[model samples]
Target: MPGLLQNKVAIVTGGGSGIGRATCHRFLQEGARVVVADRNPAGAEETRELMEGNDDNSAVSVVDVSRSNQVQQMVNDTVSRFGRLDILVNGAAILIRTPPLAEVEDVDWDLTMDTNLKGLFYCCKYAIPAMLANGSGSIVNIASMSGVRGVAYGVPYAVSKAGVIHLSKVASAQYASQGIRVNCIAPGGVDTPQMRGSTASAGTFEERNLEHPMGRVGQPEEIANLITWLSSDQASYVSGSTYVIDGGAWAIAT
Candidate 1:
């Protein structure tokens, strides 16, 4: 049998590494043509190389999702090359560990929101029309557990993720009738470079694992499983929902 996303065309932002990179691979395994997009040219190219076959079915786009023009162009180019757009995974984000909210610098706050929140907006803004033209589309925006709960580390990052959750809801309401589905996922302590950097040390990263109910953090591929499922026809009835992929960490959190 063909894969779930066979023949579908997708754009995965932040496809350079972490959850985004894993998602790109998963989408391809499911037989979707993927555009690996990221601001880091080297990282995006590397992801494309690592993908199986890496033939005409896959391409890379160096994009800063924060820029509307670049995002628009990325969508236009994808449509021009692939003839249509069917799925989008907005996985670009930044996490800057900061002092408590009051001690947070103005620049840090601005940068977080611009990339985390506004960047998602631009991707959705441009990708939606492309999907609409095809009569259906699925979008999975990667938010964080930090958004749904309190995190002492980065206030701006948390706030921006919360915005992502709400934006998914608003966009779903606006477009569900038009065959576009929008959803958000808030992942708990996943084992990614961003997580390790935020933990600030290997010891701290391990401690985070012990703190989790599963005694281990989620792997990038683990997160990608849920993402691809949501992007598939299996999730046709699902929209405007925030699926939390935390491994019982939130359940036991005090």
Candidate 2:
């Protein structure tokens, strides 16, 4: 069978590592040309290396999605290289653990929103026109369960993700008549290098898993699988919805 994304062209932001990196590889596995965009050049290169097979099918753009101009240029570059944009995975983000809403530093809150929420806005803003020109598109923004049920010590991160969830809804409404689908995915306790770095221990990791009814953290590829499906024609009828893949975290939280 032909892959789900056969002949598609996709841009995955934060494609240097974690969910972004995994999504890029998954897109490639589904037969799509990929542009791996990230603020981290080294991490982007690592993803490119990991996805190497057909050199002509992949490219890398080092960009901070928080910058509108840079985000615009990255979208322009993708079209220049691939001719049309078909799919987008906005997966770039920063996770900041604040002391409390009362004590959270202004700098930390601003940085989190700028990177996590504003960045997705910029990507969608620029990528939309390109997709419109192509007459169809699919966008999957990686949100977090924090957006839905909130997180302790994660006010900034949680709020930004909530914004992302709404952004997807608004964009979906704006573009659905024009043949585009927009959706968000909320993942919880994913086991990535970033996650491991954030928690810092196997014991702490187990405790975090205990918070989920599943008793295990998610894997990056597990999230990637859902992203690819949403971006594929297989999900032609899905849009403007938030899919939670958080090991039943929301159920237990509520």
Candidate 3:
């Protein structure tokens, strides 16, 4: 039998590493033509290289999602290369550690919002038209537990994620009638480079692992599993919902 996304074409931003890299691999495993897009050329190429015998099924596009022109070109290029755009995984983001909300510098705030929130908006803006022409599409936006609840450390990061969640909702409302599905996933403590780096130290990272109700943080593959499901026709009826994948950590916190 063919894979779930056998005939689909997808563009996954931030496909250079972490959850984005995992999602790109998962999408390809499910038999989709994937464009591994990221600002880091080396990372994107590395991801594509890791795919066994999938050279023709995958390509890499270097993009800074924060820039509208680059984002537009990325969409145009994908459609040009693949013939149509069927799926979009907006996984490009950055998390900067800040002192506190009051002490958060303007530069940090702008950078975080630009890449995390504005970048997502730009992806949706450009990809929507392509999806509309295809008659249907699935979009999965990556958010974080920081957005859903209060957190002490990165205020800009948390706020940007919250924007992503709400933006997904608004986009779903506007486009679902057009046969496009938009959804968001807010993961708590996933074991990704971003998470580890944001933790700032090995001790904090271990603390995160031990604090999770499951005795470990979620893995990138685990998050990618849900992303693949949401991107496929199996979730044709699902849209505008934020699914939190946090390994039961949120439950314990509540």
Candidate 4:
């Protein structure tokens, strides 16, 4: 049988490691030609090697989505090489625990918002046009559980994601009639390099794992599967929705 996304073209930003990288791999498995767009050159190439192998099934675009020009260029390059854009996964984000919100500097605030929120905006801004050319498309923004709940865990990261949730909602509503689906995923604790690094020590990760009712954190591939489904025709009727894959933490909290 052919893959779900056979003949589709996709761009996964922040596609170096963690959820981004896993999503790239998943997209390729579903027969979608992927562009692993990342700010880190080494990480991007690593994912490219993992997915591209010896074929042109996948490519890499070293991009800092925080920059509009770079984001524009990434989109242009994707179209130039792939001929069309079908799926866009905005998975680029940064997490910073501050010395309390009072001491959070303007630079840190800007960095978090730029990468997490504005970066998604730039991708959506450009990718929508390409998707429109195809007459339909799907855009998935990787948000966080903090965005859904009024929590104080990493103020900048949480706030930025909250913006992303609303961003997806607004954009989805605006373009639903145009055959584009805009959705957001608010993931809880996933076992990604970023999640491991977010804590002070390895022990924290283990403890955090047990905190979830599932008794363990999530895997990047788990989230990746959901994202790829959303991008495919399987989810053609889904739009303006926020899917939470937190392994039951959010379930107990509410």
Candidate 5:
């Protein structure tokens, strides 16, 4: 049987490590040509190396999603190289500081919003037109459980993710007739370098794990699987929705 995304062209932002990297792998395995875009040149190169054996099916672009010019160029480059754009995964984000709301600085909030929310806007602003020309495409944004709940100290992260969720919904509705599907995946406590590097004062790994009813943290691959499905034709009927892959964490109250 042919792969789910055979012949498709995909661009995954922050596609160098953690969930982004895993999603890039999954997209490629499904037979889609992928562009791994990241701010970190080294991480992007690492992802490129990881997909080297796949030949010309993949490429990498160093991009800071927060910059509109860079985002526009990245989209243009993908289309120029691949000839078309079918899928876009906005997975680039940052969690610089997790101070309580009272202590949160303006700079921290601005950085988080610019990267996590505005970045998606920048990508979609440029990418949607390409998808419109193609007459069909899918866009998946990586949201967070914090967006759905009251994350104690992660105010900026939560706010940015919430904006993503709303943006996905609006974009999905606006372009549904144009054959573009937009959705978001809100994951909880996935085992990512960013998560691991969070303030230790927040809690221990075990404590964090127990926060979920599943009694464990999620893996990046698990989230990647959901993204692949969402991007595939199999999810043609799905749009403007947020899938929570939080292991029932949000379903239960602590």
Candidate 6:
């Protein structure tokens, strides 16, 4: 049997660590040519090295998705190298400092919005046109459970993720007829390095886990698995949908 994404071309932003890195690995395991884009040059290089043994179907690019020109070049470089564009996973994001809406500084708000929301906008702005030209594509935007529910001390983060969800929906609606599928994955407490660091500052990691129904945080690979499936043709009929990989966190109202 062939891999799920055999011969597909994929771009995974933030592909240096956590969910982004995991998704990159999953995409490659499924036989897709991957472009691992991240703001951390070293992270991208590490991902590239980790994937070096894989057959000639993967590369990495240092990119700050928040920059429009950089994002445009990232897409252009992918197309130039692979000759086609198919899947785009917007996984690059920053966690806002936990502060009350009134206490959040302008710089913090701007950074959060720029990276979480505007970055997606810039990437889609470039990737969609390529997808349109190809006549078929899948875009998976990584959202957060906070996007759906209000989180204490996470105002900016929640708002930005909410924007991502809505942006993906509107884009999906507008492009469905043109063969481009846009969807989002809203994950709850995932045990990534970033989440661990955030939790360390906010509270105990175990306390965070208790908020979830499963009493455990999700793994990066779990999220990556869903992303891989969503990016595949197997999910052909699924578009404009938000798949929550939160282990039932959103299903409950505490």
Write the residue-wise lDDT of candidate 3 on 1-254 in tens digits.
88889989999999999999999898898999999999999999999999876778999999999999999999999999889999999999998999978888999999999999999999999999999998899999999999999998889999999999999999999999999999999998888888888888999999999988888999999999999999999999999999999888888888
Task: Write one digit per residue (lDDT tens) for candidate 1, span 138-207.
Answer: 9999999999999888889999999999999999999999999999999998998889988999999999
- TM-score, cand. 6: 0.96
Model-by-model lDDT, in order? 0.95, 0.92, 0.94, 0.91, 0.91, 0.92
Name the runs in model 4 displaced over 4 angstroms. Answer: 52-54
174: Cα error in model 2, Å: 0.9
Show model 3 residue runs off by greater than 4 Å.
none
lDDT for each residue of candidate 5 in 7-65, tens digit (9 for 90 to 100)? 99999998989999999998888899999999999998788788745579999989999
Which residue pairs collide, candidate 4?
Answer: none
Per-residue CA lDDT of model 4 for 89-140, tens digit only, reads: 9999898876578888898898999888888899999999999998999999
RMSD of each: 0.8, 1.1, 0.7, 1.0, 1.6, 1.4
Q: State the local distance difference test value for candidate 1.
A: 0.95
RMSD of 2: 1.1
- What's each prediction's TM-score? 0.99, 0.97, 0.99, 0.97, 0.96, 0.96
Candidate 2 collision pairs: none
**C-alpha lDDT (0 to 100) for residue 100 of candidate 6:** 87
Comparison by lDDT, 2 against 4, better one = 2
How many pairs of residues collide in each model?
A: 0, 0, 0, 0, 0, 0
Error of 6 at 12 (Å): 0.1
- 1-254 per-residue lDDT for model 2 (tens digits): 88999999999998999999999998998899999999999999999998857498999999999999999999999999999999999999988777879999999999999999999999999999999998999999999888988578679999999999999999999999999999999898898876887787888888988888878889899999999999999999999999999887787767
Query: Which residues of candidate 2, in runs, are more than 4 Å off?
Result: none
lDDT for model 6? 0.92
Candidate 4 global CA lDDT score? 0.91
Name the candidate, 1 or 6, with the larger TM-score value: 1
